[model samples]
Target chain A: MNVVLLDPSEVRADGGASLDGRRAEHVAKVLGKAPGDALAVGVRGGKLGSAQVVSSTKQALELEACVFEREPAPKRPITLVLALPRPPVFRRLLQHVTALGIERIVLLHTRRVEKSYWMSPSLEPAAIDTQLQLGLEQAVDTVAPDIERARGFKAFAEDRLPELAAGARVLVAHPGPFGPCPVDVPGPVVLLVGPEGGFIPYEIERLTEAGAQGVSLGPRILRVETATLALLGRLGG
Target chain B: MNVVLLDPSEVRADGGASLDGRRAEHVAKVLGKAPGDALAVGVRGGKLGSAQVVSSTKQALELEACVFEREPAPKRPITLVLALPRPPVFRRLLQHVTALGIERIVLLHTRRVEKSYWMSPSLEPAAIDTQLQLGLEQAVDTVAPDIERARGFKAFAEDRLPELAAGARVLVAHPGPFGPCPVDVPGPVVLLVGPEGGFIPYEIERLTEAGAQGVSLGPRILRVETATLALLGRLGG
Candidate 1:
């Protein structure tokens, strides 16, 4: 982890904090940090800062008051609408998009998305928090992305997507004879990416009717996580 | 796997072939192909085609002569120059770049690159081929990316990079003050990316002196794989 993240609740009014479990283990084993060593630290949904190790032990790592450095990195103006992938793929994409500083995520359901994927335990709140936290840590950012689920394509397209994407340019990442994906878009965007085999024609049509323009990233299909990062990267102005 | 890839040697003079082991297991268990089923197939570094399963058994899966359908997808006009990442990261990057149709790769040794990464089994020719094959299958493309290793940054920057990147725009992905990465360049490019903590100031200076213009993907620090895909996606025309 690039930055040590502590939940707001963990920080005492005196600014002292104690960390155990994974964070402690990572600080001790991976970082080989000792007491008095200053490390980059950030509060959950707070500011970036530095924390000096007060004490280190097998059970926990203690830190003194944080010296706030600066505000979190600016958030990307992108709302990712992705068809739910297999659990393993979902885990990686969550961390990647989060690290890229995405503003929001909508796990969508489409015809090509396997029904079994939604049953995965990775969709649980705890599991998602763990992944997004990893992303925030990787980027040294303090803001956590907001995630929502859209269980049905038609319902999401007709009811929720249009409103959620009302002021944003909505684009779907599709293959075949579509216009190329936009580059370095400076404004807010709602980008819809499909599952493994891609959204069926009917799903694409519905998304198109919902004000999303179908765009291609070229002929070679990329995995979900790769595509998400690529799209985000392309739109990063 | 999107397409079953066969080494050129696997195709007999008459174009018929038999496959066993991993590919057979995949066709049998994952794809559930039976005798007389036609499946998409491609020749390594060659063409895309279809193979009809003539026979199926526990030991081997036999196929009739392939009817070549088309040439492989056009290669991406880009070559990646990256610092050697950890082995696990290397594996994913190999597959990702291959799926994105990178024309070539040069894994360089830089100040931040851990020397231990050179000894990884993932760097072995066979192991690298396996990952690249997976990428080719995933993208339904037949060209396998050519990979090279540059043991020292200086040697690579002076002795080889100038020549290899001749006639191509060479841009290095760095985090600090630099111009934004280019998008949709309709020409060949040699993109350089750094290892984990990123290239030190001296290393970046050397790369800058070597015809590489340092470019930023903005403020959010992306992992090596994410940065690589984003750069590639941004440059995809």
Candidate 2:
């Protein structure tokens, strides 16, 4: 873990904190910290600070806080409009986007998406939060990106695209052609990636009509999960 | 697996072949192939053919080959110059690039690369072959990308860059003020990506002076593995 994350509730009135569960286990087992050892800590939605180990036990560890440093800015201002993938793929995407520090995520539906995928247990709020948390831990950051779900493509394009596209670069990844996805895009961007089979031709046309630019990754097709990361990496790299 | 891959020696004069060990296990356990079942098979450095199961045993399976079909041309002609990553990450990258249908991979040295990485067991020819086969199987292609290692940066750049850059688009990935990686590159490309911490400023300068266009993926930094996929996806997509 790059940084130890603490929830607001974990903070004591006198600038101290205690960790339990996974965090405690990580400190004891992975990091092998003992009393008096120093650990990097960050408060959720807050700043980063150094924590001095005041007490240690197998189940929990108490720490005294030092000063807080300004947190790094979150990743570029981008909104990812993704087609829901299989549960395993979704879980990995969540962690990846979180680690990359995306600002927002909109999980949407497309023609080829299986209806059953929406019912996956992995879509539970707690499950999503857990994966996002893992991403934050990996990046040593504490900020959480806002995530929303769109039930229909038309509704999202008609109802949300106008406002979302305002003053933002809109790029949609698809197979056919419009030219390659640009490398160093400036300003805010909205990246739309389709399902496994990809967005239908009609859907691509509609998105393009709605001001989204059609962009290709290259010649060979990629799995939805891999494509998402590839888009982010290229656009954000 | 999308396509079954066979070694050059696997093809018999009578067009009959048998698979043992891992291939046999995969056919029996994963694919659940039975006698008389048809399977897509590709011979290394040859053509794709249809194979019909002739007999099956616990330890081996025999097949009868039919006609061969010419394999499709590579999606794009891109040669990847990568810094060696960890074993697990390296394995994943090898498979990923193969799935993307890349034809060549050159693993090079950079300042941040750990010397110990050269000793990884995953670097063995057989092990590397296994990973490449996984990629070939996924893409259902018969040709395997060539993988080479470059131990000295300055020496290789001086001795190889001139000829390697001939008649090909060359781009180096780095963070900073470069424009986004261009999409729909017109010709063949030789793309370069640095190790985890990234190539030092001097290294990037050297590459740029040697005729590489410096480019950025985006604002957020990505892990080396993620960056590789992203670079391929954008360049190939």
Candidate 2 residue B153 Cα shift, in angstroms, is 11
lDDT tens digits by residue: candidate 1, A40-154: 9998898899988998766799999677668988888899999999998899889888998999999998888889999999999999999999999998898988999999788
Q: Write the per-residue lDDT of candidate 2 for residues A1-237, one digit (tens) a residue.
A: 767888888888887987788888888887888888998888878887788888766689888864567675556688999999889888878888887888999999989889999999999999999988888877667887899999888999888877889999999998876777777577899999998778998888889899999887665556676667777766753
Q: What fraction of correct interface contacts does each candidate retain?
A: 0.87, 0.38
Calculate DockQ per candidate and list them: 0.77, 0.30
Residue A48 alpha-carbon offset, candidate 2, angstroms: 2.9
Candidate 1 C-alpha lDDT tens digits along B123-207: 9999999999999999999998889999978899888988877889999999988889999888989999999899999888888
Over 4 Å off, model 2:
A32-37, A55-58, B1-71, B74-88, B103-130, B137-141, B148-222, B231-237
> At residue B94, what lDDT does model 1 achieve?
93
TM-score, candidate 1, is: 0.95
Name model 1 segments beyond 4 Å from true.
B57-59
Candidate No. with top DockQ: 1
